[model samples]
Target: MLLITCPECGARPETEFVCGGETHITRPGPFAEVPADVWAGYLFHQANPRGKLRERWRHQAGCGLWFNLVRDTVTHEITSVYRMGDPKPEIA
Candidate 1:
């Protein structure tokens, strides 16, 4: 089982967290004319990295706050966790 480190409530089981998808997507602004491809890319395209990945996750059963998680997909290891507004520190 994977252990997710909650930014507010310390380390907990992965079941307590909810995957919130990629972290760097920008919504189209009003009066902005974005191409269909651009919209599709934002909605569908994602990076399936093997090593450390930066993603958005919500602590559904704990603090109920959305936070950023830097985790390893291959080994199911969490490198670091932090809130959205806070700066991410370098993972040791």
Candidate 2:
């Protein structure tokens, strides 16, 4: 069982949150001008990192706010959690 630290409601079970995929994704400016392969890559490609990774998460059962989570993919340990618009603190 993994404990997810909710930015608004403190630490809670991982079940209370939902994974919302990568955080920093930008859409192509001109849809028609974008190549087929580029569009496909943007839609389908994702990095499944092993160590600490930055991901977007939503507290579905808690305060219901979307936030950034820096977690360890290997052990499912959350290193840091913060709101999307807030500045991330220095991690030791």
Candidate 3:
């Protein structure tokens, strides 16, 4: 099982967290100004890469806080984890 480290709590098993999906996804500028296609793209588009990727995970069983982590989609090797609003890490 994946051992994810929560910012509020300590390390926990993957079962305690929910994989929210890929990170770095921004909401289209403003709700009212966004076009239908653009808004739909923003809501439905997601990257399904095989290598290193950044994703969001929530500690559902622990602190209930959301955070981001850089992990490999192929091997599931996590490189780093950070808070929600923090600057994106340089994934190498």
Error of 1 at 64 (Å): 0.9
Stretches > 4 Å off in candidate 2: 88-92
lDDT of 2: 0.83
TM-score of each: 0.84, 0.84, 0.90
Better of 1 and 3 by TM-score: 3
Model 1 regions lying over 4 Å from their true place: 89-92
Q: Candidate 3 at residue 54, lDDT? A: 94
Error of 3 at 6 (Å): 0.9
Q: Show where candidate 3 strays beyond 4 Å.
A: none
The true-versus-predicted C-alpha distance at residue 81 of model 2, in Å, is: 0.6
State which candidate, 2 or 3, has the greater lDDT.
3
Error of 3 at 38 (Å): 0.7
Candidate structures ordered by lDDT, highest first: 3, 2, 1
Model 1: weakest 10-residue lDDT segment is 23-32
